[model samples]
Target: MRALMMPHRIVMLAVAAGLVAWIVLTGNWSWLPKYAPMIGQGVWRTIWLLVLSVMIGFSLALPLGLAQASGPWYLARPARAFCTVIRGTPLLLQIWLLYYGLGSLFPGIPWIRESELWPILRQAWPYALLALSLSYAGYEGEVMRGAFASVPRGQIEAARAMGMPRRKIFARISLPLAFHSVLPTLGGETVLQLKATPLVATITVIEIYAVASRVRQDTLITYEPLFLVAAIYLMLAGLIVLGFRWLESRQPRRAA
Candidate 1:
């Protein structure tokens, strides 16, 4: 296993080195220095979108996932159906539906149109945030549900036998175990959520992808801007992976 893993790691490093070398050799680096500030702002926007959406999504996922996993039919069924619908549908469609479809109808409601919140609702960010949050919640909720279910029954039973309250058992044993089990998966989902930020560009959020697109249009150099954006996203994903790996390492190891 060590030998096999060593070779795979070497190959990955070699591929990354080759790509960087190629980009440096062939690409125009001048544009980067000139537009660094704009690109930086775009990157910031992308990061904001990812952080806000994922935080909101994960916050909501906790309860929704628990409901789906353990609640009565009245609660679980609807929660399950909500997750199914959001996960089954394409995210882009959800964004469009929220941004354009519902946005168009907002004016017909005189109260909403006249409210102070109307200014916020008129912007693309709120809708994009909502859509992304809902999308993340739908997927993450299922992951959480599965993780919760995968907790060892023996642990819960032991806690109960000790006369621990249900809430205490859940808080001390079940939630932590499930969370540890699902941490890696949640990390992967976060990376995926970062990728999904590009979709907000369609609704005029002006994120990294949007900035790259503008650069391409203005300079008429398609590949350069795209390549740069790809490199940035790759770096961001690498950081996210490393962060998760560090968290995983800090977690107490399971008994053999």
Candidate 2:
């Protein structure tokens, strides 16, 4: 296997090296140093957007996922519909709806406009966050639902036979197993969410992509800032993959 993989690995490394060389030779390196702080802030904003959205999304996803996996139609139907709608629609449209559609209406509602929360409601960031979070929840909820369903019925039955309380069975056996099962999917989803953060730029959130655009506009040196932004995203995705690998390693390996 190692012998077969060696040639592929070498080719990949060569391609990567060549791309880096091309970028370095062609890119505006001086602009990079000058605008590094602004780019860094953009990276921070991207990270912040991803973190906040994923955290809130996953929080909402848990209950929705449970409801989706549950036996009752009443609970499952609404959850399924929510997932369908949010997942079906374009995220960009959702952001626009929240930022422009609802945002425009906020001032017309006298009570909402007068309230302290109005300031927060009026900001592009809040709307962006809401749209992204809802999108994440819808997608990740399905992942969670499938993960829960994939858990071994035998193991759950064993727990029940042992007189474990329902909540205890879920906390101790079901939820953990499901989480472990879905770890890779969750990691992929997180990376997708990171990619999605750029969409917030449409709503004036000023993330890494937006900063890169601004830099390009200012310098008229197109590839450098954009390349740097791509590199940053690649680094962030690498870190996420590494984090997931570390987490997976920490868990007890299941029997073959």
Most accurate candidate by lDDT: 1
* Local lDDT at 142 for model 2: 93
Candidate 1 versus the native: TM-score?
0.88
Q: lDDT per residue, candidate 1, 17-67, as tens digits?
A: 998899889887667777889899999999999999999999888877888
Error of 2 at 154 (Å): 2.9
TM-scores of all candidate predictions against the true structure: 0.88, 0.90
lDDT of 2 by residue, 178-209 (tens): 88888888989999999889998888888899
lDDT of prediction 2: 0.89
Whole-model lDDT per candidate:
0.91, 0.89
Between which residue pairs do clashes occur in model 2?
Answer: none
Best-fitting candidate, scored by TM-score: 2
Can you tell me which runs of candidate 1 are displaced by over 4 Å? 1-22
Question: Which residue runs does candidate 2 get wrong by more than 4 Å?
Answer: 1-15
| Model 2 residue 199 CA deviation in Å | 0.7
